[model samples]
Target: MGNKILVVDDEENIVKLVSYNLEQEGYEIITANEGKEALAKIEQENPDLMILDLMLPKVDGFDICRKVRKDGNTNNLPIIILSAKEEEIDKILGLELGADDYVTKPFSPRELIARVKAVLRRVDYTADEEKQEVLKTGAVELDLKKHQVRINDKEINLTPKEFELLSILIKHPGQVFSRDNLLGEIWDYNYHGDTRTVDVHVRRLRKKISEYSEQKHIITVRGVGYKFKED
Candidate 1:
């Protein structure tokens, strides 16, 4: 069997549908009907990834995502939000809450499976990158193996997502990557509906790094997305 995936949704048919498809892909599937159950299973099963629904009973997807990201143990766990809400704001909120991807209701099973594979691949890619030697630019340094960042030799803490975003930009300094490009690179897939996610992470990343480093390394290219300054 492949990696275990937790499927959380109040709808029995949706759960069954997704589980059936993912199982066909050789993944082990776990199911939860409500938010609380999802949280419990997340702790007990330690699923490799999660397919979460927004309007769950007992607890909501937003709270679940928030709690998961806040917890050090599961902060980096990959999450994909599967919701009926097609509103742009809902998509942005889901991403801002740390969801790796968002899929709306009535989605194609094939596309969902593709997204699952993509997210899993992204996780593998990030893990492989972590083995590389430390990366530095000016006074800022990133030790991927150690999962540490330092400015002026003083260590700083960053969320897993934040670190990944920074590492990608620093790895390709002076190259302008649009929001869609970044979503594909960092989230492991292109999320055309939720480009605001990139904006949110960029804003947070900018604020955190600014506190310790005087260099305005992350810059917006106006009509373009963002880039690391060359000099």
Candidate 2:
């Protein structure tokens, strides 16, 4: 038995296909066909990751993702949205709602599995060589071991990806990180030219941190990427 994954979809064949492929990779699979059931299983099963469909009966994937991200217990849970909606806004919305990744319908099973592995890697990543437990830059403080971030001594909630993004920039102040660099570092995989993912997370990070402090810690470098402004 490996890491348990909860697959949520109304289509029977899609569920079967995803379950078969994940199980082949030595992962334990749990399933739910509707939004309500998915939420219930999420609470009970506490899956390591979730493959969620957007259009589900009852609650819908967006609501589920929102609830999971808002809840203290499941705020850090990794989510990958599986949907047929190919619009840019939908992708942005999913990412904004805290989905780690998005895979549209007719996706390659291999690619999805690769993304799952990559997301898990990012979640489990640790820098054993770095001795610093806390990173302090201006008013922002990041506790690596505690997996926490506090601005002006007031703690603010940040998703896992947001925390990792901040950690990278804060560790190397004034160092410009290209979008590609950030995608590779934070996502642990190539996003196939989708730099918008990085943008969405950065925007959210700024919004959350802004509530606690006025200092602009993350600075966008015109045509390049972003850096931490310690001033």
Top-scoring candidate (lDDT): 2
RMSD of model 2, in Å? Answer: 1.5
Off by over 4 Å in 1: 146-161, 187-194, 207-215
lDDT of each residue in 128-160, candidate 2, tens digit only: 325558989778888887788888888887777
Per-residue lDDT tens digits of candidate 1, residues 56-119?
A: 9889999999899888788778888999998988988887777878899989898899889988
Q: Least accurate stretch of 10 residues (summed lDDT) in model 2?
A: 123-132
Q: Estimate each model's TM-score.
A: 0.87, 0.96
Q: Which 10-residue window of candidate 1 scores lowest in summed lDDT?
A: 186-195
Global lDDT scores for all candidate models:
0.86, 0.90
Instruction: Give model 2's TM-score versus the native structure.
Output: 0.96
**Residue 162 miss distance in model 1 (angstroms):** 4.0
